[model samples]
Target chain A: MNPLWDREILMLLGGVVGLLALGTTVGLVLDRRVTSDAGRAVVVNLKARVRSWWVMTAAFAAALATGGVGSVILFGLLSFIALREFITLTPTRRADHRTLFWAFFVFVPIQYILVYREWYGLFAIFIPVYAFLFVPVRSALAGDTEDFLARTAKIQWGLMIAVYCVSHAPALLMLQIPGYDGEGAKLLLYLVIVVQLSDVLQYVFGKTLGRRRILPKVSPNKTWEGTLGGIGTATLIGALLWWATPFSPWAAAAIALLINLAGFAGGVCLSAIKRDLGVKDFGTLIEGHGGVLDRIDSLCFAAPLFFHVVRYFYT
Target chain B: MSLETLAAGALTALTRLVTGVRARWPDEAPSTSPRVYFANHSSHLDTLVIWASLPATLRARTRPVAASDYWDRPGLRRWLALRVLRALPVDRSDGCGKREALRRLIEALDQGDSLILFPEGTRGDGAAIGELRSGLYHVARERPEAALVPVFLENLSRILPKGEFLPVPLIGRVTFGAPIRLGTDETRQAFLQRARAALIDLRNR
Candidate 1:
């Protein structure tokens, strides 16, 4: 059976649509009820985010419907945009131009191509090993030693987070788990749904009941209540969807917990970077979610760990 | 659509894809009225990126003031400049050419077409905005009715800086500040200083 139309995958997508519909309805109610200027502002932002979520879900579903290749290309393009946003915020001198050109044009395509080919060994090591060495060498050859280490490290970090980490989501398709043969798409969807749901739940919880700040300096919006509530709910959801994955209910819950923690770390780490860069959001690409980087920061941290866990245990 | 329109559309799309060029109008939404969009010159892509960031309605009437010596070569470059971009070629060679270029720029403004002008007159090192040339002052002086809009093109130099051809795919920001106009008794030097300051202001923001 085609994984695209598999019962579990369709059921998962239906759940997402239902969740979005509920969100839209709730947003409409809030918009109508919230009369104060500050409350109205929050409602407006909520509506924009919900609108973007609908578009994002449709795009994600379309990509999944096309099978592995579509997801690969879609993630590839997302990586490209995320990397562009990452580098745009990082200060790179004219000396690093060639290295950046190589990063964007050569290394990005080659990495995605390796993923498409399902050559996991190379896909896993290409950016971390080869591109890692190449970036500094190319920058050194450019002869601008000023901030050389910092510059090279930044470019490498950008590629790692924006390309490498994000690529792991699609690389999930390459995992050859026993009995999960054509269902790699479901695992990919599972990872995304859990990670993003944690984020959304955190935001919802934080807005309604959050009192104490988790990391106020790094990310003011995060709170302990929100984090715990979000992780607990999303993990329960993930566990309930164990039929979509190779893992058992308990195993799925454990993995969901791990993914949620990693995603929270990723969000905080990226928010710290933004604070250091002295900007609110990375870029204004997404309507209310900030840039592609902003939307996928959690995925960047969650994907690699989730992929490796599934690969190691299930495969 | 004509081949010119098709090429223009492709170029704009390609520019957006490659650079993810984002436009931010801080003061007012983009209007269709005649205006002079002046920006810091850095990479060769600056003009196209700014032109592409404008709304299609404004883009159709907006012509970039490009150097003929560079873009007037007989081939693809010329075709892209004249046919696709519909650039207003400015001769930067001699005094007579300078006068003719100013006349042509004013003529384009008189015809009610918006213009994208790089007032530095040449590409900078991308680190800082170079001193403003008098051409922007002169053009604004002649066409007082047209808005003198200061635009700041950021990170384009890093994407495709001076002397490099292969462009790295980095997001480029095009910021359009509140429009300024030449005061009735403002001196050319003062107006030029103010214009340069306006671009610097956008950069800092």
Candidate 2:
């Protein structure tokens, strides 16, 4: 058997499958009960969301099954698509063409390559330190100073969110825990499950019991009831899965709460970018999920935080 | 499949992966009937993107109207133009050559093959639409039965601009608008302006 599919990994996969089956049943029941036109529209969207979740979960599982290199490639491709969607909306002048090319083709691949090779020293500072200075220099060489600082800043910011942050999820596989050898996949899975579960549960709770809005201007759907309920439930679930991780039950719950808060911040920040661009979604790639960026925005925030926290305490 | 067909498939797939082409038809679904797809020209990839955006059935019968001076080179370019794209190369050096090119386009339309035409005659900076040449008007007058569809290709020039050899990976949107035809008793200038306006209107849609 591949080391990636140890006993603990199998149990995690089985749990995800069981949850998906339950979601399918709820979607079917809701599809039959909704009668009004508005209610039917919401039900149809909910069903689409559930259907896409199954496909995404299968793809993720297949990637993890192939080992660390497979996961690195998958996240690398997602980062590419997400960065494309991000820059497409944020307008840049002709002078920034070559600079944008370096960001997409050069820096992105180098960053992921470092992660795959487990070069901890360079992978941590490659984007933030080197690419940060290289972007403006390349744009300055183009000799068009129309919006020099703004354009360079936009490209660098996009690289940080789309490539740098997202790569940390697969980078988790490079962690060297004392006893829990070759089981970083489980920890990555735990972070993803808790973060994504919080998102889905927030939507469910908001629709059912949400009365007050959290941020009326930024995201109208986020409610206090949804946030507290979803994060509270996901933290408890994470604590129960502490046996798979190199953490105690209380430590697991504390880390889950922190991850949930960071994920929430990620969603709101990306949402503000959308509102600034005056568009509803980033791109129409996914059926119910807006784009690759929209689907993985929460992961963008949670992954880096989770990676550092685990590296500090456990490793 | 033939070698040419295999090469075309590979080229289409590469174009889609690099550009992430998102094609939308705001007016109606794409039809298989004979039509002229006239779009704004800004980069070399404009023709390929438009050709790749077509449905496979329509792509089989659609030929692009390309400039012979550029694509008529000796080796690989000529092979791609003649075999894979099946482009009808037009000479733009002289008046006699111009008439000959129009004759060939009319012949292709009569044979029930659609043509992808760039009426600007040359590449632009992609900021604004250039003045459309008279070839689109003449083609419309000759083949009145074929529909004239306006296609707007956004962000293609940014992908592979005029002088850049390397293509930046970006999303390109192809929007097809409602078809128009030359009006009865309309002069050449009036009909050309109307056709240009139709193509411009699709930019926002």
Candidate 3:
């Protein structure tokens, strides 16, 4: 069999199978204890998640069938919608409008095109180097002299939110983890699955045993009990999935904890952004879920950190 | 559905629940022709307050001419304005005279519709009323038969500033001034400044 298929594949499949088993068993047992309000919320969230799961699962299956280019295109669409939501909330001035147009129209497309072509070197520098210079020139052409620094910073931020942070998902195809020959796609799947799992677990744990509010002002939903419990559970699952990844079981567990922690921080920080923008949720892009930003805000934070860690060791 | 009274009722309800709603109107009788109710710009909520403050019968005959570019965007804004509110549109970027858009307004007025105008042109920090743009004067001159009602929108700037997207829940008042008739030889600039003064006068009162 393929070297990448040795144990990590089994680990992932096994871990998911095991978690589903545990989740269903525990969910049924705990049904009696949950309050009506909390139970109702869980049902609604679970249903939405189930819907998203089927959709993502279908995409995952499609990625496996179609290979890198197809998967990259899927992620590019996600980034576009997420970026649109980000810019919609953060106000841009008339001066930066042209810069924003390029960011949206030109830079994002070019970045994804680089991924499609698998030009890793150019893909890496496209946003940071080329788009960086181009945006400023566009802003300068507007000739509106007020708030120059703020205006420039806003354009930079728009790029960061819309393009750079989102580009990490597609960047996964560039990875060459030894022992995982064709498993880069699986790694991407693992990353998304783990990060989203951590998020969902935290919410579930927090609602159940959570007492003291962690940060009521920013996101009233977070709680210390939930954080500790969710991280613990996710780490355990991560360790179990070590069979599917290039890492050892312990290393997998450790990475899971890091991703979980980072994902939580991402959610909280984005919540603060929403609060600043005076919106309850980002744009109403998703039906039950708030927006594209709301869905991937955690991914934006977790992706870079996860990529760096995997690259540092596994490579 | 009288847009203003409906708006006023909603504004009143929202203010009562959060901060509180207050209003003022022109002391004189309603004009037969179209009048531009010009006031200070402050919050997104400013338009709602002015629209809601009109009398029911008069509200039916009035339209708040909003920017076509902004309100025309898909989503909640378009839904509320086009479907529920029925606001008119004026193109801010058009180089040609606003006569085309104003003609639409004239049609509304000719059909016995009045209108609300933001003389400050756009939203701003409500520290003091900003300089009046000449568009209001043009509109007023075109419909000389329409009485010019100066309205002062108070405390709205603080409640929702220009850069801020969200309204800080706070008490705001909309004050309407007495109707001012345009003179046969009144300079557009003179009439515009005097109309702006009426809004400024209500800030303290």
Which candidate leads in lDDT? 1
Of 1 and 3, the candidate ranking higher by TM-score:
1
Model 3 CA deviation exceeding 4 Å by range:
A1-42, B1-205
Task: Please give, as one word, the docking class of candidate 3.
Answer: incorrect
Count of backbone collisions in candidate 1: 0
Name the lDDT value of residue A109 in candidate 3: 84
lDDT of 1 by residue, A137-184 (tens): 999999999999999999999999999999999999888888878889
Q: What TM-score fits each model?
A: 0.96, 0.97, 0.59
In the range B41-86, model 3's lDDT, one tens digit per residue, is 8777777777666665666566787888889889878867665566
* Residue A133 lDDT (model 1): 99
Model 1's TM-score against the true structure? 0.96
Residue A88 in candidate 3 has what lDDT? Answer: 53
Candidate models: Cα lDDT each: 0.92, 0.91, 0.72
Q: Which of the predicted structures, 2 or 3, would earn the higher DockQ when compared with the native?
A: 2
Q: Residue A171's C-alpha lDDT in candidate 1? A: 93
CAPRI grade, predicted model 2: medium
What RMSD does model 1 have?
Answer: 1.7
